[model samples]
Target: MSDPILRLSGVFTDIAQYHILQGVDFEVPRGQVTMLLGRNGVGKTTTLRTIMGHWRARAGQIVLDGQDIAGLPTPAISRMGVGYVPENMGIFSDLTIEENMILAASSGPIDRARLDWLFSVFPPLQTFWKGQAGNLSGGQKQMLSIARAMVEERRLYLIDEPTKGLAPAIVSTMAGALRQLKDQGASILLVEQNFSVARALGDSAVVMDDGRVVWAGAMAELANDASLQERLMGLSMEAGH
Candidate 1:
């Protein structure tokens, strides 16, 4: 197997007085999606934040492309070619979709070719290009958030619950966009509550509980065994059947 683009070894994170993310370890392989799965409050979101440097890891290492990034600031981490989409869909409400795209183009001006590709994947972005982002529907806003992250080329994407609160049809669209991203050779570490989305997109799976990794294996193995799925994630893939 290829080396992981991102790896966390014994990572610990703290939020104010609360201690979250205790010794988490996982690997996101190059050019594939790794599903980070668990129930609510299992430190899934915290782990993503810690990787992005929004929350500091008090102990352990966050290695990206063979370099330790645990001590780096958020901007430095981002500059290292990591794109993050927080669970809150971090788009500027007052800005136009075009402006948001421009702001996210940290490397330089938005490439017209890349912009056209993104619009093809998400046609709503083109339809609402001149409109204020706040006026977009929830699904369109989610598309914009993911699109913002795509304005520039990045080695890895850390996405938190892209399917959260989205309608079934919209979730289907988001899943297709993610697959297209993978096909274009992007590595992704995804946190998703919806088992169907996770099962469909993940090449590997990591299960976390109480801030620690509890299971790691192939997505197919996890999906094939309902008992194992229940033990690790408290649900079966049967819902997707």
Candidate 2:
């Protein structure tokens, strides 16, 4: 209802000659989770990349807090208060957990209070604080990636497929952490495939099909409408259970 923290209007992305996003329009409300859902290969990931300036938009405007960010470089965008967590978790294999955190640390005195809060939210991070990131399990890697993002206190986060290959138990843990982040007033645009996980984390849903947004509404509405889920998400309500 109010001005969104991130707004994508008529966003069109082209990878060389191939167009990925076609006239995609969506708004990510501040301090709320917005789930981006679609069948595989529908450009959900591309949308996240485009937003982060990894892939420049050939047309459209990406506005963040009333400023145009579409034309900015990726590093510029990151400095503009956006954090990104890629699907691979983006943990440096050779670096220790602390080293990875230091890499994401912006040019300022470390916020001990935020670090303590992050460690409190993720205890494993405290235990493996000295361990190499590659040595940590998949779930732990995810926690580190998220913690790295938190260290900077960004205004918005673009998380891409965070639960893609995680175990069921780990997925549950990640979902819980996401809920905690949302409760803490983090504006998140989550690219997710697991319907249950998305339902648990999201306040709103934006369903994309063939690189275009076909549905946008409250998550509960899409969760309850089995027909819409089946038609747009190719998911059966029975399958979710």
For TM-score, the strongest prediction is: 1
For candidate 2, lDDT tens digit of each residue in 18-134? 889999999999999999999999999999999888898999999999999997899998998899998878889899988899889876765898888888878899898898889
Clashing residue pairs for model 2: none
Worst 10 residues of 1 by lDDT: 232-241
lDDT of model 2, residue 24: 96
Model 1 alpha-carbon drift over 4 Å, by segment: none
TM-scores, all candidates, are 0.98, 0.96
Clashes of each: 0, 0
- The runs of at least 3 residues in candidate 2 whose Cα sits more than 4 Å from the true structure, single-residue gaps closed, are none
Tens-digit lDDT track for model 1 on 53-122? 9988999999999999998999999999999999999999999999999999998899999999999989
All-Cα superposition RMSD per candidate: 1.1, 1.4
